[model samples]
Target: MNRFILLFALCFHPFALIAQQPVPVKPRILISTDIGGTDPDDNQSMAHLLMYNDKFNIEGLVSSPSYGSGTKGEILRMIDLYEQDLPKLKAHRNGFLSPAYLRSVTKQGRRGNAPYRGYSKATEGSDWIIKCAKKKSDQPLWVLGWGGLEDIAQALHDAPEIQSKLRVYWIGGPNKKWGANSYAYIAENFPGLWFIEVNSSYYGFFSNNNILDSVKTTDYYDKYIQGAGYLGKDFKSYYNGEVKMGDTPSLLYMMDGNPENPARESWGGSFEHLSRSPHVVFNSATRITDTVAFCTVVEFNLKGPEIVIPQDSVCFWMETPYKNAVQKWPGYYLGKGRYGLKYVPKQAEIVSYRFRSSIPNVDFGEGKLTVTNHWPGKVNNTDYKLGANWYSDKADPALYEGKIQGGKTLSKWRQSVLTDWAARWGWLKK
Candidate 1:
């Protein structure tokens, strides 16, 4: 009876024994970037990716330039830097991919933005995306669009069957503007596809709002990255030695949480679902504006010989002129009675402004209020703010109004990312 029972249990519970063996969990990833393009932030992000390569199974690195241009040579140059630092990185952690392996996977995608219909003819990079998606794997292939989505669009167009195997996280804002046609094609046609359009959350990586003063300027570079290794050297050379890895958050999202479930909170920040197909909210603060639409706030401390009367109440006036109209923007007291004001330009053309004080005792500082001839792409029209829920429909709508859900705040999310980055660079203990 005992022998018969043992045989029955063995036959019926075969998976029980197999499940006892620990299975390694590494999410498969493919980075499609425009590294050698106009913005050098992509290059900075790539350096951070290579430094922490052991976290994910990186399959491909393709150049998909949107606004400016990109090439395989630029990708190779960074890989060469990685090769030099491979030994040092290996000393800290295992599983760093070899330089030759990364080189083999590097390929070129579309050079410019896609047309109105989204895709052009097939390119080497687009073909590679399809091939990689079809590979037999339990894991889904995560296609990170750090640049334009043209190649991914082309890949899906050429091979629609592989749609089920793909999970895309596109760094959208201005990149979306560049690939508007292609983005429309993908969202409109592939409704079942899992896509996360990150426009503003990625900005948290470099935004001055969340970062500590020490980490923002020169302290972070001097401590962990500047002279650390080959990767550090290359990182220091880019963007005049600023730690602006805008694309790193996409990969960071995959590193901590269950890659199969994007809704779960992770180091990369959380996201909500879209109400409709992902579209750019023009003239809205829902997404971070490009550099063109930035508001510059300058503060002046009334002191020294410039102060004519200490008892006189001073009120600064800020005048912003839009097309055919000029409005006086509100100025608030920034604690300790400091004068400051913020204004987002409405038009794309040059906006002129004038600053004066009601009290004659107050001075207008060094330069007169002069707005340069620059275009502000999309200005904020509504008070709709950007958050983790910007790209996700799974989250509650109330969170979009700047309410905290699951105890998550933008500042907390930013800290989580910085902490992870520090750990990867051996700045913090594992």
Candidate 2:
């Protein structure tokens, strides 16, 4: 009787397991990074991404540039990197920035859109963005933009079908001026879409110099160089010359807009009612079509429809805790702060990102993921290999130590410390 029952249970067990299986996995992201738009913050952001790629399935990388005359210059800079070993490490090619962009950047002056050099075609950011957003999975594809929103705005304008499948985290603009550049484009292209903005003035302080006083310039030099002592060598070689990285924290904020840190606020106005968000129609008032959301920043003093906060005061959600926000923007933050003003929207995802370090990872089929703990996922290895030949054990000790200990000159100590850390973590061979 026992053997018969066991055989019967075994036969049905397979059927039960099949019925209760998890859903199929979906392709995750296509990250757009503006490699050399303005500052070194972008570089730090890139490093952070590399460190955490194991957590997120970074589908592709599309390099974008700023608006106006600087656009091609930025694209050219990316092309230069693309022509090298940089893009391969991230497993992607240049997206959106085209050959015409390269010509303008390089000043080669070939008129008309020529085929992008060294490749059959340059993948457009707009196209990739639209495709990713329309994915059938329940999980929405995240679009992180560190540069201007031209490509994404264009994509949305072209593909309205993707609206519900994607969310945009744009790190641009100052407070009280959200959608100031392309309000019409945004309103028309992405109505009811999730938009998070990371403002500038507030992020500049922590991301550039004071990471809650934990990460400093010294640590950067040390961690980046891998102990070969390239302070006076390669790094210092460009110090006063001309080398910068873009701001990562700024990008981060944009990707996960906390209601507390809004790019657009009603500076110095009281909440009589939420103000009417304007919709500019075809650069004319008569062509207007939509009247979208214009929410309130409660506890903020408003004066005649304007919102205001102290220049130094931090804005965060009061009701929805910051911890809750972080959970939404997983695998994309450096760290969290204890003190700051908070904000909450009763009906929004309200996510925040921590640097890639926070999430545990496993391999997904196409890429790795650091998913919510409640879900099922996979991980992948994202370790970086730094060459030790760049260092010589015999460098000027005083200069190296000075740089490491926060003194006047660059040295090898910084490289040593970072290399040691990387080695310890199996990112590089010791």
Please give, for residues 112-137, the per-residue lDDT of candidate 1 as tens digits.
87654567789999999998999999
User: In model 2, what lDDT does residue 215 have?
Assistant: 30
The C-alpha TM-scores of every prediction are 0.65, 0.40
Please report, as a residue range, the 10-residue window in candidate 1 with the lowest summed lDDT.
Answer: 280-289
lDDT, candidates in the order shown: 0.62, 0.33
| Per-model tally of clashing residue pairs | 7, 48
lDDT of 2 by residue, 57-109 (tens): 45445655432122334434434433342333334322323324333313211
RMSD of each: 16.6, 22.9
Q: Cα lDDT of model 2 overall?
A: 0.33
Best by lDDT: 1
